[model samples]
Target: MKNLSSNVTERTERRKGEEEQENTEERERLENNRFEDQDETTERARCEWDFHLRTVVSSATAASDALGVIEFGPSGELLATGGIARKIRIYRFSSLVAAASDADGGGGDVALLDHASAYDYYICTPAKLSSLRWRPGAGGRIIGSGDYDGVVTEYDLERRTPVFERDEHGGRRVWSVDYSHWEGCSVMAASGSDDGTMQMWDPRCDGGECVATVRPSATKTSSVCCVEFNPFGGPLVAVGCADRKAYGYDVRKLSDPVLILDGHQKTVTYVRFLDDRTMVSSGTDGCLKLWNIDDARAVRTYKGHVNNRSFVGLSVWRKGGLLGCGSENNQVFVYDKRWGEPIWVRGFEPTGESGCERGFVSSVCWRQVGEEDECTLVAGGSDGALQVFVGTRKPS
Candidate 1:
């Protein structure tokens, strides 16, 4: 009886030891898995940066005219390019859609079946597409284009034709057009002409008439280069002019620019509202300045590009905290707003005079895709080509 009792005790001890060993192994396995997951996340972020660096390797070439401006559709699935060629070209977003589909299928060929399709090029010309914009809330199926001839045309994707056409500026070149965010068809457009006048139009009315006209103050004489609507609220307009000043106007009362932002020594080429209270402007001075709308003061200055005396394009990614600038020097600078410095610089290699023009960088914009926060930067230049830069955040 004593030996049997001892044997039972030994068995119990052995069982407990085995159970403890099993628990330890399980814990180790879980720890290993957690480490692997962390490693994967880090590697993924590095890969994304690498991909962004490589995607623009050859300097994308699309348009064949001195490109004036580039705009991305709401879904980032389409790109609208305009330039001296008097035409607007649309490029599809097949690359992103295909990549997403592949990622969903375990990053394998199985997802190719669901890959996004490419779009055929659509061209609009004769009116001289000076500026292009995608209608808000339309999912990128509608586009509004302003012409050097002071005409505004709204085109539908399905019909591939202008649904609405109006010319109210009396042949003054329409420099910029913006659609309201809440109402797709509600548009507030501005035109700057050789006559040195700035006029606003609201196309939603039956007889599209000039909503307001802005003129220079007694001390200033400048041609309006560009005009943009404030992203915040209300009917505020920001206008940049050849006289090297940016003016903010409340369309309701066009007595004068509410604020006169003067910093550029040369012509101010472009001005875009970053948010409700902040705006950015670029000029021939080769400097990009950030302004405070409330006080009408310059807060920050970003100067890295060369040959700003000519034309340059500026685009800001409000949420991603990025700014893309293209200059006449044939270079594109991508800056992190937080650091106030460029994180990456890219340009085309000179190839038998086929590279970006030495003194012309026309337009730039950040292309937003689907629901993802990722965006790609695109620029247009005098070489009549479009260049795209994909952006990614560094891993933590």
Candidate 2:
């Protein structure tokens, strides 16, 4: 009976060993799969950075004109560009891309999408445009612009006429305008201006009266350069100002800021939301900062772009975790959100050009959609030069 008991114990030990071996092999397979996935993600990010200049087109304005703002329509079908020329030129995206593709094989000649045949129409503004945003849910028919004359105007693109106009900044330049909507609120417009206040307006209100106003800076002379509503939908709005600070506020509470991002040594020129809880701000001190609105702290600082003086432009592509900004050195610098160094840089000068343009790249915008294997980037130079870059996956 003792011998029989020992044999049974040995059999049980063998079964236990087999189970352990199976579990170990399964873990190894899963670990291998995890590594493969990480590798694939790394490779895809590398390919996304391989940007090529697809086309370069100078705006119809004279050589002295500076293109201040560029915005792409929601559907990516239309592009609106405006600047010191006091005109907003609208172009068909397909026409620009097709023209560039046609010139691709012709000795890499840069095709100039001229004003005569390229743009659909140009909207003349009362003053030079400082900012432009396409109103969301407007079916690409409505657009808005903030101008140097301290006015914010919304236009109906279908009718080529102004639909709404407001001039409440007391003749100070209106630097930025943005829109926000929430569950309980109708569409509200916010404008940041040199008058040191951010004002919210509801177009539905009679006489277009200001609904609310928030003064972020303690000093009365502090100019609010940029304003952006949280794109993810909320009462949150961010403002960048000449006080060398940025503020995040819930529209519901206008008296106090929920977050104060203070680090820039110079004027904060732009602010944009990266997500519901995070945002980015640019300053004339030559850096872009990523902030956690919940914690009111900067998580990252992006450098390598020379932006010590003017508004060199700041934009973020959330899908790919990329940040794009213009440099004072007349180049476009793109950075991955995870890294401080630039991943790609492209100069604004076209082929065979003197490269003597006096201004830097003033604005940049990425096509919001079409991220399956490729994407498009539109950059506007202070010299009124518009360049389109296409990023495609590299063949394995």
Candidate 3:
């Protein structure tokens, strides 16, 4: 009886040990399966986000010339675009599509809408519009535009006609226009001409006269390509010149540029102030250079595009800490301010139509709504098409 009892006990102990081992193996298998599933989910999300990084909407073909500049309304409800054909078109945010996935938590799904006909915001026929900018703080009810005829026109949102028209530069083409946030009617604009000079204009005056003009003293003679006003206000402007150099000027005393930036081997096409002391410039030399205006030094140089392909447009998203650039190569690149490599490259797809490759991208802007943390990137192509991309932080 004792030997039978012992055998029974021994068998029971062996069965319990086996059961524990099986449970341990099963738990490990489940853990492994969970890890694999997580990796797959990550990869799939990445692929989807990448797909969204490309072109989202192709603006209507009937808008006439290649689109040159794009701007978003203060509420993100409207997108304004300017083209070489002397026309300005406005697209509503309601037409855009919100991406489905939540990858960045930066904001809600990216806003990418299908191609729809522009709302024909305002038409400046015979003007040859060069740039468009919506006044900040005003509910997108006021717009300012610069034209090749050296004219700056301010249009009220409700009415289709210009409330103010000023030929501040004696009919020299106006290259860029920017309004001040502190003062509504106060505006600072720049004009670049074949004569190799940059003139600043203030439209608030009774006649909207030229406030100041800057020219190369003796050694530098280059046509100004673009100009931008400082976001923090005061008498500061950044200018890009064809002479392959950028100059910073104090509108208070424009006798000479406060600082001269030298880095681009070709013409500097665009200049934007990221903040009070830091500015960014893109050039036909196929390089994007960041400068510290206070110290008057080039802090970093970004090189990716080959050859001097007319890299003309640049903008910085103050909220996102990202910079966007458009080139004549039919491509747009996004770069993180801290990193040297581009976060992503977009707009390379063929339009299935001829002459699309020659379509130079003129401008890019970021539109945000309410308290959202993220913004959508809107670009204007030379073919008079507006494209939107809805992703963040992609490998170049």
Top candidate by TM-score = 2
lDDT of 1 by residue, 155-269 (tens): 8877788777767767877777776442322466666653466776676665457777777534334567787777666567788888778888777678967889988888887
TM-score per candidate, chains pooled: 0.74, 0.85, 0.75
Off by over 4 Å in 3: 1-56, 59-64, 98-120, 136-139, 182-195, 216-221, 306-311, 368-373, 392-396
Residues 10-48, candidate 2: write the lDDT tens digits: 999999999999999999999999999988866554524
Which pairs clash inside model 3?
66-382, 66-384, 97-112
Most accurate candidate by lDDT: 2
**Model 1 lDDT at residue 86:** 66
Model 2 misplacement above 4 A? 1-48, 59-63, 106-109, 350-355
Question: How do all the candidates rank in terms of TM-score, highest first?
Answer: 2, 3, 1
Model 3, 199-290: lDDT tens per residue? 66665665567766677434344566777777777567777888788887776677877889989888888887777778888887887888
Q: Check candidate 2 and list the clashing pairs.
A: none
Clashes of each: 2, 0, 3
